[model samples]
Target: CWLQQALRATDNPVIDAAVRLGNVLGLPVLVYHGVREDYPYASDRLHHFILGASRDLAAGCRARGLACVQHVDRSGHRERGLVYRLGADAAALVLEDQPTFVARWQTERVAERIEIPVYAVNGACLVPPAVLGEGIGGRSGFLRRHEPGRAAWTVADDESTDIAPYDGTLPFVPDTLEGDLDALIAELDIDHSLPASAAFPAGRAAAETRLMRLIQDVLPGYATTRNDATRREGASGLSPYLHFGVLGPREVMRAVEKAAVGARHSIKFADELLGWREWFHYQARALAKPEQYDRVAGWARATLADHAGDPRSHLESLTAMLRGETRDESWNACQRQFLRFGWMHNNLRMYWGKRIIAMTPDPETAWATACYLNDRLSLDGRDPATYGNIAAMFGGSPGDTDRPVYGRLATRSDGSTRSRDGGAAWLAKAAS
Candidate 1:
């Protein structure tokens, strides 16, 4: 089993599927997870989180009577064609069915080159995107197909390995992650400037703690307080864990179902988690290149392109934006969250995304800038949901009047965050 993003041991369809197939064949499932220094934004933040998760993943696999191996691609530890080397001994390969970013591209290449039957399992979403079928036009349509199937997919069948763990490997020796992970990370050739997130610590323990917090603190009044950026506990703050697959939607929702919260709050949280999030996953699966600028709504693209040459006075440099030093205080507040914690409030992100158009040279630049900042600074960046949310901000209902840089596309304001009680004080402190 070749694991990329899905780091969890339990409730992981990829691993479970591998184990089932292995049991059927009377063969042991050898799980492999590698971290390279070359992926975009391979910083201290992303590396630390990934390595931490991977360490726990190995331990978890061991507890489940499965052997898991890892490789940290750094100087002196570089292993060429590791996956291919490992694939040479396998009866069949199992991989994650990721739609966006590096995981998608890498999985495709591997499946094409390898001769064995490569099974790509959907470990990311509660209901597999493939089950929803192709060409889902919008979220409402997606929910129609998705909602009915949720109850069936919510239950996890964690498969047990029938045979002993795989010990026959001809490839290079795997690095032991349990010993000095921090020292191992320090040797890697990645961005050292972007430090690890102290707020959202890595590992299964941290993820479980966040889930408990969601049930206990956040879910009670989630319906009413989710929109408010001022309250520290308003948001569930589970995006980082969800992104890395440390906690699957199935496990999270299972906890949600048992939580002692009001039905309304639980339902609202489910809508955001399953309804909105999985919808983006489904949407991205249909697109040729979901990350590109062309994937945005045609009308919004046409209108923005039409006003590309319009004069703009609010433009800021890339460095200013990267460092969260922009003139706009509210946008800076949102950016600082990404800078400091590698995460941001969903409510603040809507405003931060929309404001980038006026703050950049052009629409294309705006899109690129928004992507760059988010993808570089945030843990949940490079996800389908991230682009989907940004796309929503860029192309929404056409306003009654065309604007300066933004043509017919509706604009957003900081008033949502700024107008609340003590909201101004929050913004001032957040930006600082």
Candidate 2:
């Protein structure tokens, strides 16, 4: 969620320097990124399929009359300017996603360094975060007044969305992914120990298939069974789709509402999740220091200092938990599902996240590791909701401040009641 780490990790000083040059030229330079991880070598998943550059934004940019330049530099068809290269008109800067906190700062700094006006586009959401922010006023104020009014805000379709129709002349094309993706996966230099699950496919077709299936078959069960992790089709398997922006929330909500018009229960749950998304964003924005990871008001230095030495052991424990080898069968089963699929049910994710913080040394390490791994893997990584979930473990979450035993600094668990023997037997059968 934070981009500072990535900026430091970047090898491309040219991106910084060139953008600065563009700014000095009075051009509205749009910095485009496919993968959150910057530059040359990146996991294929990291690189997004571009429109003129990314799949959708190119058409959107051209429709808005922004000149689409494939500024790869060496291709010198025109007078290529530096990082500060600026456009004559307002440029529609299309980023792969919202810049991480570090990326956001660096982007602004680059804008300052280049002397251009940048409108940070909310490309991640079908409806941008800013639009959502506008709808929900300042964080604390919005939630206090509107938390109860969630039904109204979400029930209304985001009327402002406009994905410009694609024109053939656009400079970008969808990445023609070739060969075996599995073989490609092995080459990414990621941890090979974690196996990829076949349950979800890795492209647009896969995303649509899952969504279509859910609308037809699974949504009917959503009202009652969505929370039950054991029922594989219980909940809307739309998290990964929503996370990847493969299916827009408005589109999904509208489709579900249209199809399940008589089924108010499903409509209510879908609305609730969207509202939860708004709720999380409001909480994240409202925090006094949203960028400060792992440290809460009273629980910062002592908590970090207390758990510095044995991170390796903590890592091992977390890895074991991730692998579904822990003592809790219910948690282990959820872990197995996440291990096999890129997601877990929302109900299970809370249980899974709570357990991780409980076993790890400090809240920060636990939160960082969980978030990092999930972001790298889950289709929905790098989302506000995901960030908010990790945030919940620290002191208090969005809707409530009640410190749950899991994220709070404490050692408490009842072996028999929370035991997963029942779940373990089910998971073992499923794994086999």
Candidate 3:
């Protein structure tokens, strides 16, 4: 259905309640307010799809068949009945359900506001499980099923899924939306406190270039050198592209598999990527206890709460870790990489996250800090996978179970030293 949030009127009291609920729920509602000011455009300067309509979209709908019946502003009342009189063959509205229960009410309100079909797009996962299977029960079960299909990621290159050849009618391309990138940035009023990461150029061409570089130059050495962090270029920097939908997961899988020379190490690296990235969605969707935002895992709340008041030690450790000043050389190297590159290898990510929980007074704060930095600085921000990965770290496993690392929070009672070698040395050099 035609999606215009601003054009739709609601009882002011109801609007206030809806906003309150959205806040309580932590859901970022996506309503098509008028066309985005200084909207992103195609390389040739044509706007194809609205920005933030979905992941990986790099254009605006102002030039499309869509009409802007309303502008999102401080005055939030408008009539939808008259807007519909403007007409379209069909309308598809998109929204999100996240963090809180208040989102459900907003969804209903929007649905009533616009009489057309509302397609609630689940914009998080790489491959939506609904498309793959009718809701695979939960996290563990979904992972079990998805694990085998790791090799099945393929591209729709052969016109099998191509929409280009279909209708003789050319797609609507909005040229008026070609925007000044600087103006858009200034208008958004993002936090200038944290400097922006490297200029990972935005465009289909740039995305392609990065992808090819990952497959050819970086991925081959991924298994061996990924944890070093000093050589930031060793790991595939494809996370941002993949997260943004600039590059599809299936396309990545296909490319890597084709290039793999039956090297077990390469295969191992691929499996880790799939498990950590693809299967993470499965875990998040499945794990009921962890999925609940307020629900902390078994013993996590009590253990972390007990020490929450004394955060000085943990804060010092975290500060050192973030600044690449950690005693451990490998962790330091990873910190340096994160400082310079705004990312670290998957192996290092687990280590860093676990260390944060171990060193932090409360596990929740640790998780929150990781999420904050990840979202703010990294190119791949605001992703469920990232959050889910952080969530997994809050609850320690075999790899990070050893403790008294931070009092009663230690999962492993019988602690034994398992030496971590490679990462520290590599990172030390990088930071130095």
**Lowest summed lDDT over 10 consecutive residues: which window, candidate 2?**
1-10
Candidate 1: give the clashing pairs: none
User: What is candidate 2's lDDT per residue for 273-335, written digit by digit as tens?
Assistant: 555665564555445435357334355334434444443332347667657776666566656
Candidate 2 C-alpha error for residue 185, in Å: 6.2
Q: Model 1 over residues 1-432: C-alpha lDDT tens digits?
A: 999999999999999999999989999998899999999999999999999999999999998999999999988888978899898878999999999999999999999999899999999899999998876778888889999999899886789865988787458878778787778788889999999999999999999999999999999999999999999779999999999999999999999999998999999999999999998898888877788888888999999999999999999999999988989999899999999999999999999998999999889889999999999999999998998898898887677788889999998899988999999999999999
Ranking by lDDT: 1, 2, 3
In order, the Cα lDDT scores of the candidates are: 0.92, 0.47, 0.46
TM-score, model 2 to reference:
0.63
Native RMSD of candidate 2 (Å): 8.8
Per-model tally of clashing residue pairs: 0, 29, 10
Model 2: runs farther than 4 Å from truth?
A: 1-33, 36-110, 123-197, 261-263, 286-319, 394-424, 429-432
Measured with C-alpha atoms, the lDDT of residue 262 in candidate 2 is: 46
Q: Pairing residues by index, what is the TM-score of model 3?
A: 0.63
